[model samples]
Target: MGKADPKESYALGTAGRGLDPRAERSRAAALAAASDLLIENGWAGVTHASVAARSGVGRTTLYRHWPEAAMLIQQLLAELFQVEPVERTGELRADLIGELRSFLRVLHNPKSERALRVIIDQAPLDPRYAEVLSACSCKGTDGLREIVDEAKARGGLPKELDTDVAIDHLLGPLVFRRLISGQEFPDQYVPELVDSFLEPLTP
Candidate 1:
């Protein structure tokens, strides 16, 4: 990946004015185009021009909103995951399970899963994809850290482990099962995962 830093402020259109209805529609169309392009031609195809051509959004408008292919990639990810920053409830086990399910919903979606897979596989060659991947990963990591930190502040997670370690213990199996084992985790997966991680740390 060239590390093509769209270096995008990622705040092109809305420095001050939030997107109007018309602008929002145009951005949505472009994003839809990006999604289709990603699935059809992979990450390499989702340029501002390609999205404009597919979405019929003017280049000026596309540029005004998504200045680079990386922006399109980021937006496509936001669309696919719809994985909003799930509000924290301060309940460690429940919070962890909720976060996993938020991600699981995306994995269960065939198109979203395929798009994610494509981005990860192509990241080495497409710097744009890697940047988006790093950005998205950071967001998730932050959320997980928040959950663990809150639990620790409440005097939970008494064991000698940091938030990141706890997260690895909680998510490692899921990753291994999904990516390495080529398997779909069953209903028991999340609860069992939470229990295993929490049990060792609990007094």
Candidate 2:
């Protein structure tokens, strides 16, 4: 048999300029356009047609990939929230502190914060958006679960503490403080939060 061209091997999917550059560029453009629209008009202003126009991709292509703006925005947030793997660091306090700091940074962004609020506010009226927002939140909670589990393993927390409740205890106050106070949380509060939560759990 004749040796098949190497290009032929990759041609089945994205090979031959069909798969790599064009697809990636289109996806990036869509995300960029969606982000701009989100920041400018909030979630209400993003539509599949608008995104396609702004992204310079065909409306058909956009529809083929993401049928709705909510899905597209969900995808955009998923990309934005991507972070390095959580570090165990062999010290529960350090690990919790690091994760919380990162979380606060993400939640504190004005545009991102506003975007999330819009999704949440619209949830009751739009069930589809609720589902999307719920999925995004669950992804974030999974990250929190990792930190809590690590703390349990390192003997920094009580053996019997329920992880879900423990996570609530740790994070609930910080979120409430942010939303209610409408002020930036001081860096000193992070250690205080860690110390307060850890103190009650330690043997």
Which regions of candidate 2 fall more than 4 Å away from where they truly are?
Answer: 1-20, 110-115, 123-128
TM-score of 1: 0.71
Q: For each candidate, what is the lDDT? A: 0.70, 0.68
> Across residues 1-203, which tens digit of lDDT does each residue of candidate 2 receive?
11234334222122223335676588678878888888788877789988988889888877755666666766665444433456667677887887777667657776556556666777788765576567656655676787787667766676677999977876777767776677768778888898898887786
Instruction: Assess the local accuracy of residue 142 in candidate 1 as a C-alpha lDDT between 0 and 100.
Output: 69
Error of model 1, residue 108, in angstroms = 2.3
- Top candidate by lDDT: 1
Q: After superposition, how far is residue 66 of candidate 2 from its true place, in Å?
A: 2.8
Error of 1 at 196 (Å): 1.5
The candidate maximizing TM-score is 2
